[model samples]
Target: MKLKVIGIIAILLVVVGASCQSDDQIEFKRYYSGGSLVYQQHCQNCHGDKGQGLSALIPPLTDSIYLKNNKRKLACFIKNGLKGKITVAGRSFDDQMQPDDIAPLEIAKVLTYVTNSFGNNMGTVTLQQVQDDLNNCQ
Candidate 1:
């Protein structure tokens, strides 16, 4: 009976732990999972499946510093598109990234994915943040 009780307690602990994710964690997971689909559909073509980018043409998403520094501008870049030259991962890319015209929520989701995946950890890019950034696009 002692072994049975121990097993029951263990199962309860496991179930409780599994369901203990915080609200922010839940939000992040939702954004991350949705972003994964968005990335595969919209971004994977040019950025590559692993975000490694094309050789010397497109910029890789592996650069965490670039992502953090350009966090605010990313929404603009995505909504309005990007052109001209920019250095990423110690290399120059002058390729043009055409506008996606996706919604603000999708932008938030994709940004959250990119900034968290591929060696980055910038945390959730909330929809409100994306909307604010979009409003200030240059």
Candidate 2:
């Protein structure tokens, strides 16, 4: 009886531990899922359903290097819009991206989704980070 009880407790512990997600993981999932919705509503029109931006017009989101290098500026770009010339995927794009007047939290969520989707793996772009970046926007 004692051995059986110990085994049951061990099994329960394993199950519980396995099912538990770290705070970061939980937050990532929340942001990613919420961002998905935000993307569909706001970004899908220009960026496309697969993030493959319009040819030579809108820059695609699949450029991991650009995303990583400009990770901090992304929040500002989203909130304030982008214009002029920029290079993505070794191609130069001179176009205008209208500003999205979304809340900082929504920016964070959508950024989290964009940075992690379309062959990107930039992890989570937290709300705090987005707010900080927005404050420093040029």
Give one digit per residue, the lDDT tens place, for model 2 in 1-138: 999999999999999997798999999999999999999999999999999999999999999999989988999898889999999999999999999899999999999999999989989999889989998999
Candidate 2 regions with alpha-carbon error over 4 angstroms:
1-18
- Model 1, position 13, has a per-residue lDDT of 99
Error of 2 at 13 (Å): 6.7
Error of 1 at 77 (Å): 0.8
lDDT of each: 0.95, 0.93
**Number of clashes recorded per candidate:** 0, 0
- Highest-scoring model, TM-score: 1
Model 2, CA-based lDDT: 0.93
Give every collision pair in model 1: none
lDDT of 1 by residue, 1-138 (tens): 999999999999999998998999999999999999999999999999999999998899999988888989999999999999999999999989999999999999999999999989999999999999999998
